[model samples]
Target: MKKILKQVTKYEKRISVLLMVLSLALIFNFCINSASAASGDIIYVNGSSGNDSWDGLSAAWTSGTNGPKLSIKNATGTVNSGGTVRIADGNYNGINNTKININKNMAIIGQSQTGTVINGTDSAWIFKIQPGATVTIENLTITNGNAYNGGAIYNAGNLTVSEGRFTDNHAYVAGSAIYNHGTLAVVYSSFLNNDADGGYGDPAYNFAAGAIYNDGNLTVTDSYFSENCAMYGHGAAIHNNGVLIVTGTDFIGNSVYGLGGAIYNDNALLMANSNFIANVAYAAGGAIYNIGTLAVTGSNFMGNVAYGAFYAPYISTAGGAIYNDYGGTYTVDSCQFAGNIPQDIYNNTEASSGYGSGVITGSSDVQGATVKAANKTMPLQKTGMPLIGFISAVLLVLGGSAVSKRR
Candidate 1:
């Protein structure tokens, strides 16, 4: 009788151990499922081979109506706030003739910069970020957008752009690439061959900013601007009506028919470690025109020209490198200005009005600017593994541990 009781007790212990293991397995499974659902916050967009009717929960097509979205518009509409939208490598054009309005905080990431393209096909604006929204765009090419203002993107809220290329965009009024009314930050981006032409009207109309127009705060870092043109306007590369900070940026081969080949500042402007090369201005300021406060440090201006007819009767075609308008304050520190046609710096108050009102301070090398070759090669970095893959690896480890304990 004693031996029988001992065997029964051992059997009960085994059953209890098995039950505990089963409970643990169930709990782990549930946790894994919950993690997967959380990962669904990331929506996938595939321009090709995707169905709109299916739920955009999976990166690829799965059985029973689960797949990526057909267009970025649909994904944006469906994604939750602060979610991410991953776009595949394909040309996304004609998906929406109207602008894609974003009103939520989110991120739009592309597979690659050159491979993933958002071409407006010269139809309409590509994106519009509404007020009170924060957005980030990365690793994409925006091209062929045509609009009255901001051919590629219009931002009324906070925006950040990285590893992006804006090319071949056209605007009728201003900002062929981007128009910002809120805070904007551009990093590791390039603006190329954008044009802002006064459209089908009197040449007297004020059209400006071939690449970017800022009415709010703007910061640019490690970016490149090249071959941007503003016809019958000012500021071929940038028109700043607000505060602007530029660092480690390059402006090359930009031209303007009016004033300021590379930049026109009506407010506070600061530049550091920037380069301006071969920029042309028809009126004044081959590289920069400042009507407010301006400061430049450790910058270089080379081969810039101000040679065309003056746009206004009072405006003089001077200042191949910089033009400080009457009543403007300027300071240059450790700056180099060389190879500029006609002159290097022109203070309008001293030359024309004789007001001597504008304050010009700091030392600059105007005789011979140090020439430094720019290295323009920038490659994109790879991201980490997907969420699903991570979850699977964790589940595998848990399963192996459970099996070992049971053995």
Candidate 2:
């Protein structure tokens, strides 16, 4: 009986030790998961029937069923290191009928490019990224947004957009699609049919960018800008007051009344393997207006038009593809210009008012080519004449080319 009691006690002690070990293991696992969540965690957002108050636990999400986190805002918590919010396929107008503000380092990803749509109201923007934040948005469409600066997004932080579309947005001042006061990188994205019209205010207030206004670093790759308009402002597609880099992109049918139908660069620009087609500017540079350091290589410019103002019909209109001012420095290489109205290259500060020292040609490192700049006889065409010039203008306007008029 004494030996039996000793055996039972020993067995109970072993069982207690095993139970304690198991409890410690469970606690360690929970701690590990919680630590991961504090850093770069993944949260699910279901658009169908998810609740905002519940935590995004794995068991809470089922196939085609609601998740714990319903909206993007609910998914955005105090994850200081960084996190990802996996959004399901649906049209999200934003949480609580307001703009989605991102004040942390996070990434918001959609299930599919076309299936996820973030529609904005007429009062607020779709997304507003605060300063010192790093945010990545992918596989989404930001449409029907409206604001004073960025109709779709107001970014004062580092932003990266991939495989996204910004369309049908309107801004009262600048950046109908995006206002970047910080670093921005765009890949395989598109900005289409956006407007920066000044919204019935003084034209002076609306000064830049119909598609994007960059006061910081801007980089774009494999993107497209189409039919963006800036009324009484510069850069219908993009206004770059900071560093700008564009590669393998296309700017088409953008219109501006001030300068740069496609882009206005006042700082530094590096454009390579891009295309500018059917862009129109009322002042100068139908495709690009450069007043700073500019570099263009392996690009194509076609069907671009630079028309003089209707009131000042005799105004000096030049550079159907590119206009380089006195303060601008340009290097063009391996570019093709075809069917551009007026001229292919115009140097405003040139002694002869055509291509000159403002633009450099072939060098030891650079191999340059061009269609040619127009002579004095081309710029002398009058509207009163029913000659080739009048016929060209009529055909240009009729051929789906955007036209801008400046007083």
Candidate 2: pairs in clash: none
Query: Candidate 2 lDDT, tens digit per residue, 1-407?
Result: 99888656645543453344345435533432332223477777767766776665532556443345777666766234487877788888755524878888888889898898878755568889898777888999888888989989998987889999998888888898999997788889999888887543475675658899998777888998987888867899999887777888878778988778899988877777887877888777889988876777667776777775542521454577887776666766567666776777776654354332333332121112232233112111111223453345436655766543211
After superposition, the stretches of candidate 2 with alpha carbons farther than 4 Å from their true spots are: 1-39, 59-66, 78-80, 94-97, 198-203, 310-316, 350-357, 362-407
- What's the TM-score of each model vs. the native? 0.77, 0.76
Overlapping backbone residue pairs in candidate 1 total 0
Name the runs in model 1 displaced over 4 angstroms. 1-40, 199-205, 312-317, 350-407
RMSD of each: 24.5, 21.9
lDDT, candidates in the order shown: 0.73, 0.72
Worst 10 residues of 2 by lDDT: 375-384
- Cα lDDT tens digits for candidate 1, 46-135: 888887777888889988789998888888888998888899999998864237999988888999999999998888789898987778
What's the TM for model 1? 0.77
Over all chains combined, what TM-score does candidate 2 have?
A: 0.76
